[model samples]
Target: MLARTTDPIVAIATASGRGAVGIVRVSGARLAPLISVICGRSLKPREASYLPFRDAGGEAIDHGLAIHFPAPHSYTGEDVLELQAHGGPVVLQLLLARCLEAAVESDASTGQPRLPGLRVAQPGEFSQRAFLNGKIDLAQAEAIADLIDASTEAAARSAGRSLSGAFSQEIHTLRDALIHLRMLVEATLDFPEEEIDFLQKADAEGQLATLQAQLGAVQQRARQGALLREGIKVVIAGQPNAGKSSLLNALAGAELAIVSPIPGTTRDVVSQTIQIQGVPLHVVDTAGLRESTDLVEQIGVARAWGQIEGADAVLFLHDLTRSAGTDYAQADADILRLLSEKLPAGVPVLDLWSKQDAAPSTGPVTGMSLSAKTGFGIEALRQRLLEVAGWQAVPEGVYLARARHVQALSRVGEHLILAAEHLAARAQSLDLLAEELRLAQNALNEITGEFGADDLLGVIFSRFCIGK
Candidate 1:
C-alpha cells in the first residue's frame, strides 16, 4: 500500500499517437472513488467492465474497458484502475481530463476521507512506486529503461534477461561470497585476545585467494556485459583512397558512406549505427588521413584525427594493391607508427588489409582476404570485432548495463583487490578494510539506489517517460 499521506496519481501509460487503444493508469487510495465517479457505478476488484467514461459536463468521452486492482496487489502496490479507450490523441486527452475532474471526490465507499486528493503521475512515478513497495529492485528498474532504448535485438534480449534478474543474481552471488569472507574476518577480529594468528592462519589465506579469483571472474563477465550494453565506437583511419568507405559499407550492409574513387571524397566524418549479432557497432567513416593544401581537406584531416583519438576502436586500412607487396615494408612501418602516435592508447586497432581480392594469396601479415563486393571474410571480421570488445558467444543470461554500472563495478573490483593485498601482507588494517567494504557496498547500492533518499529518487525517476 502507498503511504497514507500521499495522494493517488494518474497518467496515460502508452506511447503517444493514434493507436487501436490507449490506457489511462491511476494508482493510490483515491482510485476507487475516481473510478466510481467516472463509471457511474461500483467496480469489482480485478474485473473488466464495459463502461462509458463521462466528463464533468455529463458527456461520454469514450466508451471503453475499465478494470480495478485493489491495494497491496496492484502494479504500484496500491488501489489501481485502468481505463482503456479509443487511441485517438484527442479522445485520450479528454479521458485523462475526466479522471482529473473526478479527483475532487476523494471519499471511500463509506464516505471516509482516505488519503489525499489525486495528483498527476510523473514520468517514472509508477515504476518508482513499484521499487519503493518491493515489487522490483533497482537493477530491474534500470533494465526497463535499457529494454526501451535497446538498439539491437541482442541488446533487447540481454535487457530482458536483466529485467528478469539475471544480472542481479550474478551480483548477489558475488556479494554473498564477499559477505561470507568479510564476516569470517570480522568474527576473528572480535576476539583479539585469542592466541590464534588470524592473518597467518592457512584457512584465512585460502579463503582470501578463492574470493579474489571469484571476484576476478565476475569482473571479466561484467566487462563483457558492459560492452554489449554500451557498445563500441569504431573509427576508420588511413591515407587517402585506402578503401575505408568500402569497409564501412561492407559492415553496415548499406551504402551509408558515399563511395568515390576520388581522394578526399569524405570531407567530414560519416557515422552509422549498425547491429552485428545483436551488438551495436557505431562505425565512423572519416576522410582519408593525409596533409592537404585545400582548406576543407585540412579541416577534414583534423577531424579524422580527432575521431581516431576518441574512438573505442580504430581500423587502419592498408590497401594491398596500392602497396604492390614489394613496397609494403615502408607502408607497414608508417601504418604502425601512425597507429601508435595518433590513436588513443588501449583502444583496439584492426590492421585491415583492403582490396584483398586483388592481393596475392600469400602475405607477410596475417591478413584476411576480404572482398567488400563479395562479402568474403565478413564473419571473421565480426568475430574479430567481438573478440576485441571482450564479448563472448555464450548465452548465459547476459544483461544490459550502463557506463555508471560499469564504473561502479570497476571501483568494487579495485577495492576487492586492495583488500586481498592488505590481508596477504598480514596488515591488521581493519579501518582500511572497512573503508573499502563501505565503498564497494556503495557502488552496488548505486545500481539499485538503495542507499540514497527521496531527493535522489526524484532525480532518477524524473528521467522516465509518463507511461513507465
Candidate 2:
C-alpha cells in the first residue's frame, strides 16, 4: 500500500487502567469536527490548549489538555487530535466514550465526508499507517514497538537508536554494495562472450568478497542486538549441596532462594532476571541433580535436567568440599560429564565452584571460585556473562530484535556464502545469485516490515495492548 486515507481511527492511546493522565487519540479528515463537538471549541492545530471534557448532556467529565495536529504532518500522516484527561479508570472510559460519540455525530453531518465512527484501531495500526505514509520505515515502526516493550534501559536505548534510523543506515549501506555487484553481474550477462572473463576478473571477485565481509559484520552486530532484546536463559544445575541456591541468591543480590548447608534444601527451580552490562540473564536455579531414593528429590532432578536442555547457558555448579575424596564426588563428576553431553553445541558451560566461604581456594578444577557470602569473583562472572551473551559495553547504538531478525540475517549470510561460491567457480549462476540476493533482501525487509504481509502485520500488532 502506498498511502492510506484518513479514516478517523480512534483509540485510547495511553495505557489502560489508572494513571496520572490518559489520552484519547482521534485521527482522520473528520478529526477537527469531532474535536469541536467533544470539546465545544475548535482546536488550534499543534497547540496544546486546556479544555473541559464533556458528556452528551454537556456535563463535565474532567478538564485536561487538547492538542491538534494537521494532516500530512501528524504521526499517521493525517489530521490528529489528542484529548488528555485525568487518568481515572471511569473518567478515561467516559472521556473515550465522548470522543467516539462526537466522531459518530460529526460523520453523519453534511460535507464532513462519511468516515468510520471512531473505529477501534488494531494493535500498531497507527504506527503501520505511519510506515505506509513514508513518515517512518518498517524498521522504525518495529522499533517503536520494541521501545515500548523493552525490559531494560539498554534495550530501550537500542530501540530508540533503531527508530532514529541507525540500524537502517547500516543495512542500506550493505544493500547498496549488493546492488552494485548485482548490476555488474547483470551487465556481464548481457554479453555472453565476455561473461567468463568478467566473472574471473580480480576486481569482480574482490568486490563480492568485500560485500560478504560487510554483510558478515552487520550480521554479528545484529545478533548481539537480538541477544540484548530477547535475553538469554541460563540454568544452574549440579549435585545436591553444590551451592546452587547460593549462586542464585548471590546473583540476585537478595534472598530470592533459600540457601542452606543441608543437602536437598531446594526442591524446585528458582528463577530471576539479572542484567549484566545491559543484557538480561534469565537465571534458573534448579534442584541439584543426583541419585536419590526420595520421590521428591528425583522429581527435582528431572526438572533440573529439563531446564538444562532448554537453557542458552548452563552453570554447572560443583561443591569442591563435597568432592574431596568422597564416593559422592565420583558420582558428581559423572553427572557433570553427562550434563555436558546434553548441552547443544555453541551453548556456553561455566563451572561454578561454590561455598567459597568454607573452601575459598579449592575447586573441582580451574572453574571460577564464587562465594555466596563474600561476593567474590561476582564482577568477573558478570563480565563472563556479557562475553558469553556477546554484549558490548561500548555505547555504539544498539536495537532490540527478535528471533525472526536473527533467522533472516542467518539466511542472508548463507546467501552471501552461496553467491561467493558461485562467483569463485566462474559458473553461470547469475540466476541463483539473483534469487539469493532477492531472498536476502526480503529477509532484511521483514526486519522493518518493508515487504510485510498483511497477516504478518496483524499477528505482530495483535500482541500490543488494547487501546494502544
Candidate 3:
C-alpha cells in the first residue's frame, strides 16, 4: 500500500455498530482551519468542547464532543481532531464525509483549502504513521495489533507490556551492549601499531559472554510470548467409543461436541479453543480412526488424518474398556502401528487411555489413563500438553511476541555463535568476528524496525484494521 504521509486522512476510529458513541478521527499537519470549518469555532489545543458538527450549508449535522490535539502531541505526531458522536453508522459516515469535505473547502480569508488532498486512511495507516514518525517502534506498533486481537487475558497483558515498551526496551539494551562491543573491536582495528591489546584490556570476551546470556534470556521469553500469541493446534484421533468427544468436552468445560455410545458420532472435525493457565489450546475432535466400509465414515476417517497432518500435536486416544477383547486389542495395535508409520515427524503424539471409570486398573498401559466423565487425570493431561508444547509458566515481565520475533532472535543467536567461533581464532579472525557482530546487531535491529524493508512494513501494517 502507498503511504501518503503529507495528505490528511480520516477514518471512523471505533468499530462499526450502533453503540453509545462513535468517533471520526482526522490527522494532518494543521487542522485548525478544518476544525473551524467542521466545528464552527477554533478549538483549544488538547481540549474537548461539546459542539455541533456543521455542514457547509450552516446546518448542524450532529452534536458531538470535539477534541483537538496539535501536531507533535497527537497519536500520529500530527494535528488530530476527534468527533465523538452518537454511535450510529449513518452518523459516523456523515461525520467522516463532512471532515473530508471541510478539508477541501477554502477559509473565508485564506482562500486556500485547509487540508489539500484529504482522503480515507488505509488499514493500519495510523499505526504505520506513528511508527514512521518515531512515536513508537515497529515492535510497539505490532503490539497494538496484538493487543486488539489477543485471545486470552495473558496474551492481552503480554501485548500491553510490549506496547508499553518493555519488549523494545530489552531489545534496545541488547543493541546498546552490542554497540559498545563493536566500538572496542573497531578501536583495536584502528590502532594496529599499538602493542597494548584493546579488547583484552576491556575484557571484550567477558562482555560478549554476558551479551549472549542476555540474548538467551530474551529468546526464552520471546518463545513463551509467541506461544501465548499463537496457540497450539491439537488433533484428537482414536478408535470408536474411545471418549475422544468426551475428552474434548472435558477440556472445553462445555458440551461443544456431541457424546454418545454410538460409533461414528463425530463425522467431521469438531474444534474448540480453551485456555489452560492462560495458554490457548485449539482442540480438534476428529472422527474415529477405523476401517469402515460406509462411504461417509471412510471420508471422515480420511479427514481425521488430514487434520492430524497439520496439527502441532495429536492425541492418540485408546479405549481402556476394550482392552480385554481380542479383536479390540488387535485393532488398537493396528491403529498404533499406523500412527507410528503414518503420523508426520516432529508432531508430538500423546497416548491417552480413555474411560478409566469403567476399567479403573487396566494392566500395563503405556500412556496415562483418564476418565473424561469423572475428570480423572484431566489435570495431568493438561500439564502434559503444556509440556509437549514447550510452554512454561508465564514469568514476570513476560511480553507478547510473534513468530517473526522468535526467528529474528534465533538468527541473532546464530550470528553470535559464529562471532564467538571467529573470536576463538584471535588475531586472524578479528575482522570476521566484527562482521559477525555487525550481522547479529542487524538481526536484532529488525525486531524494533531500526533496520527493515519498506515491503516488510507494508505487510505488517496491512494486517491491522482501518483506523488502527
Candidate 4:
C-alpha cells in the first residue's frame, strides 16, 4: 500500500492466463534506458516497434511489440513502456524480471544505475498516479475500475460515460454555480450601509432555487447509476412445498435449485445471479422454513434467516393451494409473526402466492398470485422487484455512480438547504450563508478529488487490480 509515484513500476497488464498475447507495463519518470537495456533498442514515442526482449545474459526472453510513451503524454503523465509478448506466464515473468534487473544494473561509464528504484506496481497505483498527475479526477479514476468490472453492457457504457467526464462535468457545473452565489453573498458583506438591496438586485434567492432544482436532478440520476453499479441482493424464503425453488428456477430460466414434492428437499442455500433489464439480481434460494427434527435442516433454517437479515429484499412465497387448510393457516400466521419481529427494517418483503393454477377461489386474496411452473405473473413480479428497488428506465447520458457519490450529493443538498435558510435572514446572516455555500462546494469537490484525504485515496486505489 506504500506507493511512491516517483518509483518506476512494472506489472503484468493483462489477465493471468494463457492467451494470444500478454502485456508487461512499466511507468516512471524516465524509461529510455530501461527500454534500451531490455528491448535492445530505444523505442520511438507512441510508436509500436517489433523487438526481441532480452535478459541480463543477452539472451532473448521473448519477441514482442515495444511501445514507448514520453512524459506528460502517457496515461500516468510519465514515461511509459509496454512489451506485448506471447501470453505465457513464464514468458511474461521473465520479461518482468529483466525490466527490474535492467533498472538496478549500473551503467558502465556513469557508474549509476541504468534505472534506479524500480519496483512492482501496487494495485491501482497506475490510476492513482494518473489522478495525482492531473490526467483525470477521482470520479474518473473510479470509473476506470468500474468499467473493467462492469457486469452488464449498460453498466459498462455508463462507466465509460463517467470516465469520459460526463459525471465530472455535471459536478463542475454545480460547483461553478455555488461559487457564483458565494461571490454575490460575500460582495454584499463588504458594504453594510450602502442600502443598495444587493440580494434583491443580484437575484440570489432565484439562483438558490434553481441550484436546488438542478441538484435534485443530478441526485436522481446518481441514484439510478448506483443501482446499476451495486445491484440488489434478494432472498427467497417460504415453508417446504411452497414453490420457492420453482420460483427461483422460473426467474433464472433454468433448474438452478432442486425441486421436489418431499418436504425439506432443500437443506442448503442455493444462489444464482440473474439480470432484469440490465440490473443484476443476486437471488438466493434457502431451505424451507418450518419445524424440523433433523439437525442439518435446523442449521439450514437458521442460515436462511441469517440470509434474510442481510438481504435487500425478501420473497415470502405462500402455497396458494393450501391456503384453505387450518394447519396451513396456523403455520402461515407463525411465519408472518416471525417476519414481523425478526426481519430487518427497510428491506421490502414481497408476499407471493404460488401455485395459482391449482388454488381454489378463496374469498379474499392478498399479494400477487403466480404459477412458477407455468411462468404466469413472472413479468409482473420482476417489475415489482424493480419498483421496490427504486430503479428507473435507463435514460440517455446515464453515467455510472457509486454510493459515495450519492452520499456526497446528499450532503451538498443538505448544505444548500441550510444556505437557503441563512439567506432568508438577508444581511443579518450573510456570513452563515457564505459558510453554508462554502461547505456545499467542499462536498462537491470531494467527488472529483479537488479535496480528498490520503487515507481515502489509499482505500480507493487499493481495490483496483494491479496494472490498472
Candidate 5:
C-alpha cells in the first residue's frame, strides 16, 4: 500500500445484472487518448456526452453517455472515465472488452500504446487507491465497504456516519490530547530538575483522568455500534413439542419452520435471522433435546448440543400444559443440568413457559410465559432478548464498528491504565510513563487506520466486491 500503482485499471463499475444502465470505469494517468479512441471523439471534462462506442476496427458496438473526470477531482484522484451503456450481461462484457483492447492499441502518429499497462481492477482496488492517493482516509475507505454490506437501517445509518468521518473525528480528538500530553512529558524528560514540579503544576494526572473519561464514553458507543454490525446468536433448546419452532416462527413473523403436533418432527437445525429494534438477532431453532431411538433424531440432538455450546444466549422452553407432571418436571431438570455443564461461562440462559393458552389453570409461572398461538408476551420477550444482547439505544447515533475496533480500544485502555500507574510514581518512572502514553497513542492510531500492519489491510480490502 505504500507504493502507488501507475498502471491504468478498468472494471464493470455497475453490479452484475441486466438493468437500464451499466457503467464501465477506467482510472489512470492521462486517459484522454483512450477516451477519444473509444468514444469516437474527445469528451468534455466533467460533463456527460452522448456518443457511440466503437471497436478498434471502427465498428459501432453500442451507444451510451460518457463522462470524463480529470485528475485530483475524481473518485480515485486519477483521470477517470465512466461509460454508461444499456445494462445487459453481453453489453457490459463487450464494453469492458473494448476498454481493455483500446488501452493497448497503438496510435498511428505516435506509434506507441495509448494507455500502457492497463488491466482489470482487483476487488476494492478503487477504494484502496482513493485511500493511498489522499482522497480519503483509511477509516472512510472502510466505511464505504461497511455501508455497502450493512444489513439493517441502523447499521446503514451508522456506516454513513463513519463514512462522513464521525468515528475518525473522535479518534483524532483522542490522538491530539495524547500528543499534547506527550509533549509535556518529553519536555520534562529533557530537564529532570523541573520534572516533578512541572507535571504537578500542569495537572498531568487531571489531564490523564479526563482523557480516560472520554475514552470510556467512546468505548461505550463503539461497543454498541459493533453490536449493531455483528449480532448475537440466540438458540432455542427444549424437549420435543415444547413449541420451540412455533416460538421461532412467531418471532420471525413467518412460518419458516414446519410445526407439527407429533414429537421428533424437526430432526435438524433451522435458523433464521430476526431484527429486534434495528439490531439483528440470529435466532436458531435446533432439534429438541431428548433421548430418541431414531438415528436421524440422535444426530439432530447431537447438533442441538453443538449449537447450544457455542450460543451467545439460550432460550430454555418448558411446556406449560405438562408443567404439573412429575416425569416432565424431572426430565426438564435433567436437561437443565446438561445445559449448564455444556455452556461456556457467562453465557445467558433464559427460561420461557410455552403453550400458556393450553395450560388448564393459567397459573403463575416461574419464567417468562408466552403463547405463540395467541401472540401473548412476545413484545416483552423481545425486550428481554435486547437486554441479553446488551443493546442500548443511542439517541445521538452510533458509528458502525467491527470487533477489531473494540479490541483496539481495550488495548488503549490497558496502556492508559499502565501509564497512570507509572505517573503516580513521579520522577522514578517518568520514562516508563512516557512509553506507555506513546503506546496508547499508537493503539488509537490503529482504530482510525492511521498506521497498521499491511497484512491486516490486505485481509480487510480483499473482502470488498470488484469494481468498488
Candidate 6:
C-alpha cells in the first residue's frame, strides 16, 4: 500500500451480484485522457453522459452512463470516472477488462500510453487514498466499513455519525483542551525560577481538572459505543436436563440446539446472537457439566468448562425439580465451586432456576425462575442480560466505536492521571507533567491519523472490502 499510493487504479465498485445497476470506477492523478478513450469524448466535469462504452475496434461493449469528477473534488481527492452499466456479471467483467485495455492504449497524438500505471485497486485502497489526501480521517474511514457491515439499525446509525465526524469532533475538542494545558506547563517549565507562580496564575490545576472531567465523559460514551459494535459473549452451563438447550431455544426464538430427555444430549456448544435494544448478545449453550465415565461426555464437560472460563458472563442454570435431594445439592455445590475457581474475577455469574413450571412449591428460593417451555421469565432474563453487558442506551444515541478507540481513551486517561499528579508536584516535576500531556495528545492524534504508524494504517485499511 505504501509503495503504490501514487499509482492510478480501477475496480468494480458495486457489490457482486445481479442488480439494476453496477458501477466500474477509476481514480488517478489525471483521468481525463483515459475518460476520453473509454468514454469516447471529453466528459463535462461531475456530469453524467449516456454513451456507448466501446472496445478497441470501436464496437459497443455496453451502453452506460459516464460521470467524471475532476481532481481535488472527488472521493479520493483525485480525477475519477465512474461507468454505470447494466448489472450483469459477464457485462461488468467485459467493462472492467475494457478499462485496463483502454488505459494502456497508445494516444494517437503522442504515441505514448493513454494512462500509465492504471491497475486494479486493492481492497480499501480507495478509502486509504481519501485519508492520505485529506478528504477524511482514519475514524471516518473505519466508519465506512462499519456502516456497511452493521447488523442492527442502531449500529448503522452510530456508524453514520462517526463517518460524519461526530466522534472525531469530540476527540478534537479533547485534544485542543489538552494542548492548552500542555502549553501552560511547558511555558512555565522554560523559566524554573517562576514556574510555581506561573502555573498558579494560569490556573493549570483547574485546567487539568476540567480536562480530566471531559475525558471521563468521552470515555463513558466511547465504551457504550464499543459495546454496540462488539457485544458480549455469554455462556450457559449447568447439570444435564436443566433446560439449558431449552433456554437457548427460547432466547433465540428458534430451536438452535437439540432438546431431549437424555442427560448427555448436548455434546458440544451451540451458539446464537440475539439483540436487546439493538445491543447484540452472542450466547453460547454448552453441554451439561457433570462427572461422567463415558469418554464423550467427559470431553463435552471439558469443552463446557472451556467456554465458561472465557465468557463475559455465565448463566448457571439449576434444576429446581431436583432441589430436594442431598446428592443433587452436593452436585450443585461442586459446580459452583468450579465456577468460582475457573472464572475470572468480576465476571458476573447469574444463577437461574430452570423448569419453574415443574418445580415443587417447597425449596430454597434463589435466583430468577424461568420455564423455557412456557416462556416464563424470559423477558426479565433478557433485561438482566443487558445489565450484565453494561449497556446504557445513551439518550443522545451511541456512535459506533471499536475496541481500539476505547483502549486509546483509557491510555489517554492514564496519561492525564500522571500529568495531574506531576502537576501537583509543582517545580519538582514540571518536565514530567509536560511529557505526560504530550503523550496524551499523541494518543488523541492517533484516532484521527494525525499521528500513527504505517503498519497500523495498513492493518486498518486492509479490513475494508474491495473497491471501497
Off by over 4 Å in 3: 342-344
Please give me the total number of clashing residue pairs in predicted model 6. 0
**lDDT per residue, candidate 5, 1-468, as tens digits?**
322367899999888999999999999998988988998888888999998999878987889999999999999999999999999989989999999988888976688899998999888888878877888877788889989989999999999998998998998998999988888888889887753677788899999999999999889889999999999999999999999999999999999999999988888999999999889999999898889889999999999999999999999999998888999989999999998899999999999999988884765457799999999989999999999999999946689888898899999999999999999998899899999999999999887678888877777777788888
Query: How many backbone clashes can be found in candidate 3?
Result: 0
lDDT of 6 by residue, 112-222 (tens): 888899999988999999999999999999999999989998888899999999999999999999988888777787776753677899888999899999999888888
Taking the tens digit of each residue's C-alpha lDDT, what string does model 3 give over 308-343?
A: 888999898888888788998898788778777877
Clashing pairs in 6: none
Q: TM-scores of all models?
A: 0.88, 0.92, 0.97, 0.97, 0.96, 0.97
lDDT of each: 0.77, 0.77, 0.90, 0.90, 0.89, 0.90
Residue 229, model 4, lDDT: 92
lDDT of 4 by residue, 80-129 (tens): 89899999999998888888888999877578898899999999999999
After superposition, which runs of candidate 5 have C-alpha atoms over 4 Å from their true positions? 1-4, 360-365
lDDT of 1 by residue, 244-311 (tens): 88889999899988888898899999998877677777899998776679999999988888888888
TM-score of model 2 (CA atoms): 0.92
lDDT of 4: 0.90
RMSD of 6: 1.5
Pairs with steric clashes in candidate 1: none
> Cα miss at 362, model 6 (Å)?
4.7
**Candidate number that wins on TM-score, 5 or 6:** 6
Question: lDDT for model 2, on a 0 to 1 scale?
Answer: 0.77
Off by over 4 Å in 2: 1-7, 106-115, 193-202, 361-363
